[model samples]
Target: MKEEDIRELELRAILEASNDNIVIADGKGKVLRVSPNCYSIYGMKTEELVGKTADELEKMDVWSPSVTKRVLQDKKEVQVMQHTLTGRSVMATALPVFDEQGEMIRVISFSHDLTELRQIKEDYEELRAKMEYYQSEIQELRDKDQHMDGIVLKSKELSNVWQLIHRVAPSDATVVFLGESGVGKNVFARAIHDKSNRSKEAFIEVNCGAIPETLFESEMFGYEKGAFTGANKEGKPGLIELANKGTLFLDEVGELPLNLQAKLLKVIQEKKVTRIGGTQTKQIDFRIIASTNRDLQEMVREGKFREDLFYRLNVVPITILPLRERKDDLLQLCEFFLDMFNEKYKTDKVLHAATINEMLDYSWPGNVRELENLMERLVITTENRVIYPSALPFHTKESQSEVFELETEELPEQADNLQEALRDVEIRWLKRAYRQYKTTYEMADYLGISQSSVVRKLQKYGINS
Candidate 1:
């Protein structure tokens, strides 16, 4: 073949093999040539469009608003999205060809099929909406879970105590909480009231020790109008009267004087109260819950507390153990208090692992209240994101060793032989070590015993930890 003819044939082959749909039209908008791929993009054979005009193709319903016709009219390049009757979406660009005299000769158009891309974009949008909906649902469920799981108590004894509180909360029984100061007695009292049938009513709390001896009767039962000197003229209800149909929590009930104990007992037994200097006795309906760190039985024996009142108030007794004994719940309480102070102070502070270990090793004599205060102080005083042991307010050499010393108790003297005495000592040490450490491996490491020996001793001694 001639070199010029070979060049022309190569150019024609290049046009036919293009990935995009190629069409060549005359300046008058008559289609003169089309690539074979036009069948895939426009659902039409190339021969059908070879000799057709834009006006004729419009009648055949191949494409609307012809790109070639637009380029011919404007005598410039034009790009547009196209819709064909065959339901294919396409992007088409048309350019006008000009001769040396600046006269329009032909128009060429390139088109890309966009139907699959549009479908994929639609699918992605739908999936994004579904993910957003599921995320909202998960957040809602997590909030509900936190609410339902009220107080954090992990020790077996404390867990049992919580279960007992729930069981007795539905009734109108008088409950007495005996524990050390700051051992969360009031918290348990509120929990009981919240879970009871009278939850909708007010839960009134009174510190019996804070009230004066002379005003104890008037403070507990409402005084009538002008009943006493300096009393409210309109007559105000007292703690007992204010707690009608609800729960009255008398904290430090052991502080009530011997003379007033008889009167308080009469009011509780009869469910009626007579205010100071008042003639009429009014009926009161309420549940009474009392808490005291003192031993009421010892007080009764010592003639400081009334035996009758003690029996009346002790319908169900729940004693909360000190914080040092329930070591399993230390981390949980720390997280709760950290979250509380973080929200209050608007700071995101976290405790370091060493700081947590130090807290676990210290004897918490002030119990949950002390931990809460310490967490708040750390958040306010510590400027860094992580809290270290040196920053703790109670960090000291004595405090670090206090927990272990308190865990050990005096040896029982009843053992007859040296071997039996050694066995008793071993049991006591094992029990204390188990309470301080979480796992058998930890206890073994702390006590200088093998892990297998720790397990065997725990099983032999009937220890459930």
Candidate 2:
């Protein structure tokens, strides 16, 4: 072969082997030649691109702000970031090749694909933003948990209750809390008092059921010195008087005798109390917060409770739902009490997954108090660091058996093959976990699987997480 022909073939081989897209254009920006990989970068065949001008290709949206055009116009090297019709991002640079007479001869451009790098940068930024958002949410939840006064307010029902409490706490509207025993009525009553303007003053809790009938009058309304035997030498203030400028929580108000109920009603209505065997009536200023588990309306209809007194105390009634109905808070409550007792007793006990599932299934009849008590018992009695299903009390599993039966009864009809039956069970569990937990991390923890596996299985089954 001739030496010139050999040199031309070598240059062609170099252009073909180059990784970047290389294009050579004339001084007027007319395309002269393009490397084979130019098609991949611009989404056009080499033959279609060879005869096209830079301005024509730019109009076709092959690549915007052509580096070749810039190099040709400026007669110098130019670099630009270009977006191509192929949906590829590129960093393109063009250098003008000048003849010996200082006249432009050609423009040689090189383009490096940046699509994958740009995508990676975007994904990193999105993940960073999500992390910040999740961290803020977690911190907010921790703050709420610390200040809730041993109350787990995770459920929507409890959130509404908190809203109602805030609305009524600012006013002294004679609030009353109605719920089953151990539903944290006393805690809520104290919460109301603390949220009020009189929070700086005394909060006297009077259990009407615990006071004896004979002593109820003196206990509620103080006795003067020497009024009766065993009376204090100095005049004593009554419970109502002691609560002046503060809150008086009357726990189990329904247990008060009908005669005493009349007196209590007078004290609430008049905001004044007269000491026993005393002639002068004393003025009082206080807020009344009452709670009762019994049906005072039924008592009034049965002639056991005074009707007028019932109306006076039933002004702003707040009913707290039982723990069974607010299952969303059960896991948090359990973990809270467990951590509390663990610190109190200096133990390190963790609940196993099975034990947690069993606890979730059981219906807590005794409410939060029962759950607290059970956690304390388990923390104290469980021998190992991890408390498993066998550590659960017999009554808990017995109660859960009915729920388990109901859940199992609704299972899909028996499949002809074992594989189908197993798949049906898997789908049922996935749906149940999805409904019970708020996040995939929680679902994975409850279902005893990796988070990635949970996501993949959910996608495979067409389950929307």
Candidate 3:
């Protein structure tokens, strides 16, 4: 072969063996040439893309947002990483080709398959999303940064309770909220429902204490039109029916009568409920959250409540401590409720330090509910820019037990007159030693209580702590 023939053969070999996708197109962006590398990237042969316009690969699902914009805008070379019109990832280089006189005559595009790199990128993105979800859920369980609407809180005791609720709410267990009326058992129930699998369904709450016995059956298990003398004409679906796939909170469950206990038991045991004076039985699926201040277990022993139903309903127990026991959470809760009621009442009456101290000192027998009511009353009734201790409904007094233990100071001598105060000091030091000192010896030195005394108190308190 001649020398030019040899050079032409070499050029063809160079183009065919090239690793990058090289394409030569007309000035109008019609493809006229394609190199071999185009195959690996686009899942197509060189000849396939040669005759098609760059815009014609719509069916392949490739998104080819061309560097055409950049090149056209700047009238210069452009480099871009984009998915092809057929959904293939490519790193592309585009430039305008000019004629001998410097007038634009053609356009050339070169691309390389970056599908593997793109796959790696997508995998990272999916992983990042999963981590974000896990982190959010973890935060919720800790109640550290708890959420209400868009709010986040870090109340210590409240966070502990929030985390416990998240852990317990998902089970098929029965939860009995122990709090004063209006302490927000209903809110807790709603939170449980929100975290549960049945979140997509209804949430029904029935106040057993509020409704009379005559209407109990109609309100809970449904009723035939004539089942009661004055029932709805077409008949009404009870709360049980309305709460088909979600949760039903029996507030004041202590008020449910003895006769109705048997009925409610049947519904819980068989997952079915019967309508009053109606023969049909319906299968029921739901979780139960019951709340009351009454001692159901004690009531059962006293013959006021059924033993079997009490056992069944106590599947998963969460006893809410009264606000007095969780004094660590009082200030935090006060601040939160203040901000909340401020928004509701559209007022910014700040609580005075003395009033806050007074609020903290009182033993809230009614728990959070009572505190909320007191705050609402103060907010509504007070006209001053600041809340005063005088605004409190009653004088702040220490609980009887606390009042009995008050002393001028600790004594160095053991006297019968100081026995009760000294005993209180001994108990306090025992707790402080075990928890804070992490050793009995150090606690004994601090409180002048013996290691043996600490040991005995720990046993009396039934503490392994």
Task: Pick the TM-score winner.
Answer: 2
lDDT: which candidate is best? Answer: 2
Task: At residue 4, give the lDDT of candidate 2.
Answer: 100
Where model 1 places Cα greater than 4 Å from the true spot, the runs are 1-150, 397-465
Pairs that collide, model 3: 62-85, 62-86, 62-87
- lDDT tens readout by residue for model 3, 105-188: 667777778888879999999999999999989966855445463222344555667788889878767888876664567777
Backbone clashes, candidate 3: 3
Which segments of model 3 are wrong by more than 4 Å?
1-158, 396-465
> How do all the candidates rank in terms of lDDT, highest first?
2, 1, 3
Q: What is the TM-score of each candidate against the true structure?
A: 0.56, 0.65, 0.53
- lDDT tens per residue, model 1, 380-400: 999789886777766776644
> What is candidate 1's CA lDDT for residue 122?
89
> In order, what lDDT does every prediction score?
0.85, 0.87, 0.74
lDDT of 2 by residue, 81-125 (tens): 999989899999999988999889899999999999999999999
| Steric overlap count per candidate | 0, 0, 3
Report the poorest 10 consecutive residues by lDDT, candidate 3: 399-408
Q: Is 2 or 3 the stronger prediction by TM-score?
A: 2
The candidate with the higher lDDT, 1 or 2, is 2
